[model samples]
Target chain A: MTLWLSMLGEALQAMSANKLRTFLTALGIIIGAGAVVLMVALGQGTQTAVTKSISALGSNLLIVRSGSAQQGGFRGGAGGLPTLKTSDAQALLDLTSLNTAAPVVQQGAQLVYGPNNWGTQIVGSTDAYLDIRDWTLQSGRPFTDTEMNSGMRVAILGQTVAEQLFGSADPIDQSVRIQKSPYQVIGVLAQKGQSMAGSDQDDTVLIPLVTAQRQLVGSQFKGTVSMIMAKANSAQQLASGEAQIADLLRQRHRIAEGADDDFSVTNMASIASTMAQITGMLSILLGSIAGISLLVGGIGIMNIMMVSVTERTREIGIRMAIGASRKTVLLQFLLEAVIITTTGGLIGILIGVGAALGVQRFGGIAVAITPQPILLAFGVSTLVGLFFGLYPARKASMMKPIEALRYQ
Target chain B: MSDIIRLAAIKKVYDTDAGPVPVLNGLELSIAPGEFVTIMGPSGSGKSTLMNILGCLDTPTSGEYWLDGENVASLDEDRLAEVRSRVLGFVFQGFNLLPRIDLKANVALPLVYQCVAKAKRLQRAITVLERVGLARQVNSLPPKISGGQQQRVAIARALVTQPRVILADEPTGNLDTVTGQEIMTLFQDINKESGVTMIVVTHDARVAHYARRLVYLRDGLITYDGSAADFQEALA
Candidate 1:
């Protein structure tokens, strides 16, 4: 071990004698490691952001959307099918397996507050909408059951809509007009920002289902519901809940057992797990692509080492002639290669952590730079140097002492 | 006197495309400890090949060669390296000091292969460098020192291992006459002080005169093996 230390010391002295050459040789390894770290960080950051957005919708929840019909040819969009009705939501809510349920209807129109006008989506839902969406109003409460039943004119403004219509001023009890229909703004929801799908949660209005069905949209859209959302009692029971709801809806609609159910239901936990799996695969793919660059870096180390062998042929002969074994000569060069790569790997990891932190600070996403990947990067780099450095070191060691000594 | 090295019926043949060529053919010789010997020959007279064999850098094709109480002729490469490190100290015509290392480090390099302790190796190296009159230049690199000084450092390196014998292959080949004579005087001092045997290979008759005995070779045969004075009288 002492001998190894001395040999390593000598090798380091030799490398240090040529600073620019050493630095340039190390550059390839640095870039390879840096790319690996940064790519993994980006992939992980995107996955985290995506997961947070999905988790915001609450666990154990499922959304059932109306499905399109297939014609004699292919299907396009919903295929102008008859819309879902409030009765379907009612039937699903009556099921004992469900936690809470709400039916939704949506319309987009120009909203006017004072002289300022902005186009915004207006959604119609029952009082159960707050429970299903996991939302709580920040100011005055959402309309009560009586208010929803009586079709009272009140509105809950989404954050962005509130900002556009009322600025800093509280919109509670203020009035906003939609399509010439004036309504009292009852509350402004807490900022929910945007969903994973990039839709602005704060850019919409919420009102009672009956009022939106009658006043703004008219009878032609009566009995037409866009979607139904409900929570299961627990994630374990979600599948049973979905099955029960599907059977109930089929019976209510009087559809046959073998026929297509004309609807689709997705559990939130399953969606989140699936998204995480896809993201993890993406991270690995990107990391492997960066690994190719590391391979190239290994080749670069080999190239430089071959040149070093040629340049130091006389030195090798001197050492060998002085009593250095072939293994000693081989190990000296291998140690040099490993030192360069391992140091480069460490520096690259530091840079990666710093970059991830910067992205978290600026991008407002929870980007975690874990130690496992950093260690992995470093380990891979040293192995690369050792593996690729072997051939050149072997070539150097195999040289005849006489030939090496005579080499000019 | 103890016979430190012996060669009996040794032969070294090289295969050429044209034919086989013999460098050393059935040579027999012996040398005792604490003796100074020089091998002299003209160019291509196989003197360097004989030096290589004597230094344990090359083995005879067929021989019963013994060195320092061991049969070194049949030893493998690694064993030969071991013999070279433990039994022999070597100086080269080119003054082969590793340019990257300092004088002290170069002198200490052999002990590293021998697995000597760092502190002891450094101490021994410093002592040998001082013995070679290079104590003040211990930290200097080979290129930074004069040609005579570099040869001194090489001598220190060869002597620092404190082997039984020093094998110098044309030690003064690259030095001027004054530098070369000074180097020979230093070698004589080392041999006289340490009581170690020295074998120098040289074509120059003046360099050979520094040795107490000279072995003359021509066409792979020893033509004369006697005192330098006897050869000088014969030439005159």
Candidate 2:
């Protein structure tokens, strides 16, 4: 053990003597390790963000969209043409298996508050929209039932709309004109950042469903709504809730058996699973790139060590003559290689973490870094050193002292 | 006195693509403890091969060889390394000190292989360096010191292990005449004072005169082996 320690000391001395060369030799390893750490951080970070966005979408939601329109047998999947009614959403709330059902209608309009006017999406939903979305108000309160029933002109401003119109001032009790109609702002929704679709969630203005239906978007049909978003009692009930909704809607519509209903019910898990698959594949791709770079780094180490062993032939001779055994010489060179990779690994991890945080700060991307991946990166780099170093060290130890002494 | 080194019919040959070539043929020689012996010969006289064999760096092709009371001719590579560290100290013509290390580290090289504690070995190295008149240069790198001081550091390294036999191969070949004589005199003093055996190989007759005993080799055979004074007198 003492001998090994002393050998380590000597290896350090040799490395310190050629600091620039050592670092250059380890550059590939540095890049490889850095890529590995960054890949893990970004991969895990993206998954977390996806999950957060999914949950931010709603509480275990099953979204119901109107079926595709058939025009001369040319069907496009963009089928959001509003065939469901607000009555259907109200009827879904009768099912005990559901937590809440929010009927929604949407339109884009220019919102004007005094001298400030900004174009944004206007969401018309029942008060149950807040419960289904897990949404909280930053100020004031949700619209009352009598207000929604009477089609009163009360509104809740999304954070971005409030910020644009008020700029950190209290927006409650202020009046905003939507499509030239003045509505009093009753509440301001809390910040929700971006949704899973990468669209800004806070760039909206919310109004009661009946008010939007009567005054804003529902002039074509008597009681039409764009969609119904229903929440299940729990995750396990989502499938059954979807089935029950399908059966109940079919029966309500009085559609015959074997006929395609004009409405579609989708389980949110499928969306989540698809998102998970994309992120999982992304992590694997990033990991493979890192693995390939590590392989190249191992080769780089091997190449440099070969040159080092050849360059230090005379030194090996001197050591051998001074009673250094073959094993000792081999161990010495191997120790040097390991030290290089370990040092490079540490530097790479530092750079990766720094870059990850930089992305989080400047690029506005979420990145997660944990200890296990760091340890894995470090361990793999060390193993690469040992695996690649063995051949060159073996060559050094195999030299005969007489010929090595004569080496110039 | 029991001989510290024994060689009986030791033979070494090289297998070349041209054919086999014999280097040492049926050589027999021995020297007692505390004796200083120098082997003198011209180039290609098999003197270096004999030095390598004596230092345990190479084994003889055939025959029995004993070093410090142990049979080492048939020992494996690791055992030879062990024997080299425990019983032999070596000096080379070019003063083969590892240039990257300081005098203390160079002198402690053998003990490093022997697994000696760093502090103890370094302390012993400093003591031996002081004995070689290099106390002031103990921490100096080999390239920073003069050729003579470098050779002195090499000598200190050889003495650091305090081995039974110190083998020097043309120890003063790179030095000036004055520096050469000084190195030879240092070897003589070390042999006399420490009671350690000294075997030096040189082509210079003047350097050979420092040894109390002399062996002369020619064509892989010993031409003369006797006291240095009588060999010189007979040649004269």
What TM-scores result for chain A when each predicted structure is judged separately against the true chain A? 0.85, 0.86
- Span of 10 residues, lowest total lDDT, candidate 2 chain A: A73-82
Which residue pairs collide in model 1, if any? Answer: none
Docking class of 2: medium
State the lDDT of candidate 2 residue by residue for A1-408, as single tens digits: 998988887788788877887998789888888888888889888988887788888868999887765467666464455678889998999987798898988889999998999999999998888888889999999999899999999999999999999997899999999989999999999899988678999999999999999888757765888889999999889988998899888888777899777789988877887888899788778877887897798899999999999999999988888888898999999999999998888898898889989988999988989897688789988999999999999999999988888898
All candidates' chain B TM-scores are 0.98, 0.98
Write candidate 1's Cα lDDT for B1-236 as tens digits. Answer: 26898988989998899899998888888999989999998887788888888877788888978898888998877778788889899898889998867899889989988888878888999998998888898889899999889999999999988899999999999999999999999989888988899999999888988989999999888899999989988888
Worst 10 residues of 1 chain B by lDDT: B75-84
Among all candidates shown, the one with the greatest DockQ: 2
DockQ for all models, in order? 0.63, 0.70
Clashing pairs in 2: none
**Could you tell me the TM-score of candidate 2?**
0.91
Q: What is the fnat score of candidate 1?
A: 0.54
Q: lDDT tens digits, residues A74-150, model 1?
A: 66465145457788888887777788888888889889999899899989888788777778888988898887988
* Cα deviation of A226, candidate 2, in Å: 1.6
